[model samples]
Target: MPDDVSTAGRPHIDIASVQRLAELADYVVPFAIRAICTLGVADHLVDGPLPIPDLAKRSNAEPQALLRVLRALAGKGIFTETEPGVFGLTPLAQPLRSDHPVSLREAYPLLVGDLQAWARFDYTLRTGRSSFEYVHGMGYWEYMVEHPEESKRFDGSQAAGTRVEVRTVLSAYDSWAGLNSVVDVGGGNGMFLIGLLSRLRHMRGTLFDQPHVVANAHGLLREAGLTDRCTVVGGSFFDDDVPSGADAYLLKRVLWSWADDRAHLLLSRVREAMREDSRLLIHEPVSFPGDSDEVGKAYDLILLTMGGGCARTEEELHALLGGAGFRISRVIPTPMFPLVEAVPAT
Candidate 1:
């Protein structure tokens, strides 16, 4: 036998490489779960396990295909095949339910909605441009406006994240307690403003975004019992002037979607709207100094391929704010992201 051969004269197997290959093959799970989510399969399985044919009938999926999907998911521990052709939810699948406490029903769709766009993500890496534009022949925001149904799902996803942000800002930043009024620049559907004003009963807010986006905000603001406390304005923040002279101006989850030039323009517009006494609050996902910021890094890549934007570091934010004629007063760290408070540079 050759020295390189095993005792039985067989080739040695590389288990690590095999494991890596298996991991790569696991990409199918995301699309599988996305299909399950789109079909509302988990919703039907909520009460208990059902046979494949019945589950398919309820979910509007083909019987054999649903059985295979269920089996594949069960292998990954997301769902269970209780018997030959019956399936049920595992604890991990609960969040996929629309009525679950921490439902990801909408978020999953938003995450995987750009299925085709991602196919051209390599083009973005090659040309440093948006794959979304390449794939759809339109920018991300433009596509959202043109497709109202997708835009609604995006809003629903943001609403869930906004609730977390509201809770974090209230507990982490003390300055909000003293501000009487704030303006939310580029606020989407006014979810953040609604949450903020609802808690800070003494404080009021102005929600500004595109006309189509703001139209939905009015009903939500009213539903939150903030009809009298908040004002909704519809206009492009870049083309139109921001609401002027509020106690604070908020750019929450807004700045990450543009390149430096456009981000600078937005900051300058907000700065122009600010008075000497006005505080500018930036609530965004800031990329920290270490490898610990995996989520921040992932979001940065999404911004890169989805639009021509990036997640800024603390230093990057400092430079951007300084360039926009503002001085950082404080930085409040939160589990969600960072809240950077700034004042007009004089």
Candidate 2:
């Protein structure tokens, strides 16, 4: 028998709806954590468990306000409340510690600080324009050229992230065994060249980037003691030809920085310079369709916002390489990025 109670007597709650709301609410936590990490709150706690007042003092944040932020983070297992007002770092917060091997402090702030520009992301969705160009008055590269300090932060933060990935890439590739020279297209500060040359004693390398970028490469080369073996070339990839006659040409995190047209142009330039047997190695986070990975999705938005760049699928890469007069030889996966090796199709 049906109950006499009206339908309105039943509870109006929906579990799925409640869960979705909870997830939406949780999104702000990561930004808060980014803010705290950027403020070096975790570094201050490194010495010992500290009260909220002292922690706020060290981080230069207001005590009451900072406590509220930390309290929210504490609920997420990032930090723990030792007692009434004392807080201590947790295992999950270890990466935020400035001195950690793979510390994300710099990377976190760089991303979060750029959040303001993203408020205009709807402009990209509506007009197919870059959020950066919509919010700022210029493209990312132009802005970087004008703002030296911000450029330094952007370069340093990117290089720091690249350091972890580069080691994995270096291990995945067989040493440039028979190659005399390798050209790293768009190599900023020669981080990749340093890693490769460190392993291959017989190899000489060229680090090609903008004038200012290359200006700093010599210092890195000297620090790595590869100044005698490496050359730093300052020129635009679009206007100038990459140094020709190298056995292997490398583009790490470069192609994804442009749209299809620009990528095609860059690859075509590389093809024109390549000998019949020259190899091209492209290292990037290759996206696969229908597979929505977190890093790929986040990077997709980043590329959209930063410079109208994007993460490409394997099929897209194949078509781009094919159009550029190159044949896909192999796609090797590393711990970080996938290396797509190609040779002149002719």
Best by lDDT: 1
- Cα lDDT tens digits for candidate 1, 219-323: 887688889999999999899999998999999978887778999999999999988999998888788876685456677787888885678988888898899
Specify the poorest-scoring 10-residue window by lDDT in model 2. 107-116
Q: What lDDT tens digits, residue by residue, belong to model 2 across residues 43-109?
A: 9988778998899888999999888888888998988889978999999887788897667677665
lDDT of 1 at 158: 73
CA shift of 108, model 2, Å? 1.9
Candidate 2 — which residues are off by over 4 angstroms?
A: 1-21, 24-27, 110-113, 145-149, 171-181, 195-203, 275-277, 334-336
Evaluate model 1: give its TM-score.
0.80
lDDT of 2: 0.82
The C-alpha TM-scores of every prediction are 0.80, 0.82
Judged by whole-model lDDT over C-alpha atoms, candidate 1 comes out at 0.85
